[model samples]
Target chain A: MSDALYHDAILALAKDRRHAGRLDAPTHSHTSDNPLCGDRVTIDIERASDGTVRRIGHFVRGCVLCQAAAAALAASVEGRGPAAFAAAESALARVLAGQNDPENGVWAAFLPVARHTSRLDCVRLPLVAAKPVFEA
Target chain B: MTQALRSQFPILTPSLAYLDSAATAQMPLAVLDAVRAFETSSRANVKRGVHRLAEAATDAYAAARSDVAAYLGVPPSEIVFTSGCTAALNLVAHSFGALMKPGDAVLLSALEHHSNLVPWQMLAARSGIELRFLDVDAEGRIDLSALETKLDARVKLVSLAHVSNVTGSVLDVASVVATAAKVGARVLLDGAQRAPHGPLDLKTLGVDFYAFGGHKVFAPHGVGVLWARRELLDAMPPFLGGGEMIAQVELAHSTWAAAPAKFEAGTPPIGAAIGLGAACRWLGTLPWAEIAATEARLCQRLLDGLAATPGVRVLGPQSLQARAPVVSFALEGTHPHDICQIMDSAGVALRGGHHCAQPLHKRFDLAGTTRASLALYSDDSDIDAFFAGLSKVRKILL
Candidate 1:
């Protein structure tokens, strides 16, 4: 086997995501295209009474990195409030700052993403698209 | 000699499988030496130089033009050097398209690269000339039946690629020429992909214009050749006005130079022109029949290997005779970006995108396909690495 950038977990995330569809009448949804590579991703979510995410769905046409990140984001933000969103944002910032290895958190699955420093946005585009929705 | 070809390319390290020659070829040592020799020994402006160095540079530049013209079997005066193939096509679209009037139409194939398509489209929009298409089959070859049906009195031109960069499908130029003749429409062929593969004789092609990139034929960038029939060049207005392309300059109106000189505006790509000449000379020495046989073998191996893998769908003609060395395909259940990344990890460099043939990609109902093209440098080992890399993607993504 080749020394691939994607490990088993990242590939697993890419293959099948629970949030791989669009939600009808989503409370907050936004779709954006990555201008450089022309990959598109849509984030959809329903919020609970406490302003936490009730359910999430994603319609992404992108690379494995984006798809895996979308799947990871969907899985991580379940039932979490605004505090968790901020933590995820901070973790994403650290990644942009050249910290490729993050441990024991929802973002830790993205450890393999550091190799293509150029592709940082592919792993983070989902969070950027969905974060604004949760803020409202 | 074929085996020794690899050593001539410095970029072909043992581990790197550079499979993207359809995009741009790697430069050979002969070209580099020629460029270095000219730049270091006799570096001066061309054409109007009076000194020894200036005269040497001018001779070298003119010699390069003669070399390229010889490669294409055209006289030097028929060849116009341009920035690249796109510029060459645009020169025609603007210059020839000027002669076209309202109700006049141009027929193009869906298989043309954007370089050939967009220029004509722009002309059609600017002028009232109608734009038409020759239908492309699912295999990505242009339908000659459609061409016969579409050719009519109103059609002024027929422009197409000699080979489809996306599908690696070769167009039947003779049939296209015959059909266009029925309508009395002129033909302009994009030879960007075709020129690198083999020698071209303009008399045999019988097209009004043929344009190709020098970089694609293992030369340096920025130098491209446009061969137009002398009469057509004389008839068409100069695309640009500047020092070299002029005859007599007046304050208000300036007379233009003859044919090829009229099309070439400013000082040309000097070093690049010399390098391209060396590249053409190097290709001229090779046994093309032997080269074609090897390419066919390598292409078949690539296609067959891709076919063997599950979920892999090869695009274009299955027969080696029907296609160029390019192989564009999409793997089911995997995006091109994913496939490229996974393969890239294995040091297999292939292209993954629309390849600037977006209309053809749209016709295929694909966002893009991964392309792996071969050249003289390709071997059985590269094909093995490609299939091996693809299998890895299959294992992971599928």
Candidate 2:
């Protein structure tokens, strides 16, 4: 994804706060800090009643990448089952690693965000936070 | 002073303008030769063997200790060598934390580097002591008025940096020491940033403990000095327990040696210590007044040039009266990282970040700023190069 596309997708997700509320499912959260830039992000993941990922949300207090990452994760995996959720997580990683194009298929809307791999963790923190809930 | 002193450092031959001396100063040939001579001729561990090599190593280490002591104007007995300033400050926090009780307070300035702040913060958490901050003024100077009011009898220790790493604002050590003295509080000065530029005399400064890294003074890394009062050193327990520090080790009980030895537990950085001693001696040979004058001139030139640039705001005191050669600035619409990137591409090296002083950055309402710090080796041409790079950045951004 191009930088503009990535930024737009992340910003769009951030504008919708309702998606961050699906926390009744088994939840797990974790925070990672980058001391070099004072960037910190806390990701919260919720697995639904069907053992699918209902929502991935993050409350981050850091750089733009962190905010974008949280938004990207929340937007990508809503209502998806565990399998699709894992695929999305891997897809996000691939996008950040400059390996795969996020703008393709179901991830087409997220393609704009694929160019910013430097902040992929910021985009995927919510998935990390929700991983334990899905695994357990 | 700089021209005469520049001749001593052969590394000056390169086209590279090294302005990051606060990170690490370039070593003089004297120090390099000393290390080579020691490693090439004879090398042995001190205070362990009875052989001739051991004797020579021990003598060299001991001589280095005395040299550091004399350089800092402290007694040789009070100087304890550690890996660097971080270790020295840690030793103070760890060793002295044993003396504090619950509810006691440790006061620190707002501009302390993480090395000086985190150790005390950990101690505060573990010992249930209150950690307080001495406020800073608008220009990044320590708020002396607030410091006077906040320093009370309940405060056990008052630790602060002699010069701020980010703003390069020099604290009035005499006033700070006197204030702490009034409260009967122990004071530790983090001299890592000040040792290269300022005049240091422990007797005049009257701080109980002072720590500085060798790397900031044209010496090797992995060597530093922790200068404490004789009484304080004698009273504090050893930070680490190991071979050289122990007089006798029993299965149940062990007796440790004196101040310097007790603090240095394992095999010390022998060659590094010797190189530091030689660096100090070499620095002594330079005309300090000339170096200081030249640096002050360069600092003014840099500050004036930066201020002239549109949208640029220089941090810290506008006047160079009590500040060092370090200058931090931010452009209105440009991020510090972007500024640094542009400057780096133009071959003008500079630092861009909070400089490990997050609280201070927050105080100034900034994420980070681009910093250009200078040393004795910096000249007019360096300042010109920096300004030229800034001009390029301005043209691109505008």
Candidate 3:
């Protein structure tokens, strides 16, 4: 059932507020919205001169799944470069689509989300907001 | 009696308590049987064919119209069947809106569904007509106290919800009609939430237009009714142009048919229309007063249960007076989607979101709320399961 989707691990990740809020002056940021449920996710990043990520932040006005996804994404990519962020996003997408498992991280907390097809987008909104940075 | 009523809806199981009737009600056996009978015995294109099956289909369609008209207490000729409530409202907006000057206004409420509000916005953009809104009160009812200031000779229409889908606040129709009569403004009510509760008499309500969807009334989807005064229908042009809507076509021009046929362009949802007519006839047999009393009792139970909870806050009118059995509430520190997910696992179906009334949610300073709406078939078990689900939500999310 969908009840398994709200496990303690995901709830704890969602409750993690260290990465919540905007950067003082972000180098890049993007916002994505779930039109069906009116959930919004904003991902802000501060990058070094070498284009590596210095810090990551997120602001989510959405459900628990969305908040957890954003928190996990921010925690995973804080000290990494764009290539590492892309790899993390790919791993999560594969796990959510039931294609593969997340390599080794808190992303496994999102494994239950695969069964609830209606909520897959809720877990993906964070990744969607972060993609445009690499593209630019 | 509740068991017997519940049994008529084959989808209702003993373990499943559906509280999302405001979204789309489950169809009863009578309506389903009517659709099956029509499809199996006499299914054909309506209004044009000369064969025996075609004649039977045409007759059934007309009879369905008559049945629906009888339910609305209006003449069959005045009822125009559209694809759904959205289409019905759009038909009026496009056709009647074409009659307005650029400066005329259509006064609508702040609490209208997107179906009611967007079409008027589109009309305003197309015709350069002014659009005005009546403020919604703190309790979510349409505040018509200041309506006189908004009314004038320039306002052509005053459209509002008969009963709000999100808040369940029933509008004061008599007061609205009386006030609008002063400035000669026509009234249209989006009756999508109200139609499922009981039968209605448009003549007594004295409104110029009414629209409701079939799916909300236990009939099939893709069908709805738009009732208008015959004179208004006669004065307006056709919203759409197709084969059935035209009388005689030439390279240069074509003449239009009468009101109902003129509004229904292309092929209609014949089976769905037949099913809606059957549903109306079936609903006519039930005792609405008794059903209303049971619904009120169930609503009170739900309200008291929500009140008893630690963090729960009801959004609409707390009292059951002058409201449908729709209840939207917010629990502190928990999102509506999470509550709904947990509730669904507990075998209780509830809807959680803005319910297409985003402005109303914004008015209440909420992102979304969990909604439990009832129908004639809903009983005490549904409410019991609802509270049980809320208890589970408290344990898990809180």
True contacts kept of each: 0.30, 0.10, 0.63
Question: Candidate 3 lDDT (Cα, whole model)?
Answer: 0.91
Q: What are the runs in model 1 whose C-alpha is more than 4 Å off? A: A1-4, A27-38, A44-56, A72-97, A100-136, B249-253
Q: Candidate 2 vs candidate 3: which has greater lDDT?
A: 3
Report the lDDT tens digits of candidate 1 across residue range A1-136: 2244577777788876678989987888988777545677899988888888888899998888789888878877867776767777777666556576544365666765665675787888898788788777
Q: Model 1 residue B291 lDDT?
A: 81
Badly placed stretches (over 4 Å) of model 3 are A102-105
lDDT of 1: 0.84
What TM-score does each of the candidates earn?
0.90, 0.81, 0.98
lDDT string, candidate 1, B243-352, tens digits? 68999999999999998889889889999999998998888888888888888899999888888877777778888766899999988877787778878888898888
Per-residue lDDT of B152-217 in model 3, one digit per residue for the tens? 999999999999998899999999999999999999999999999999999999999999999999
Comparing 1 with 2 on TM-score, the higher-scoring candidate is 1
Ranking by TM-score: 3, 1, 2
Error of 1 at A12 (Å): 3.8
lDDT of each: 0.84, 0.77, 0.91
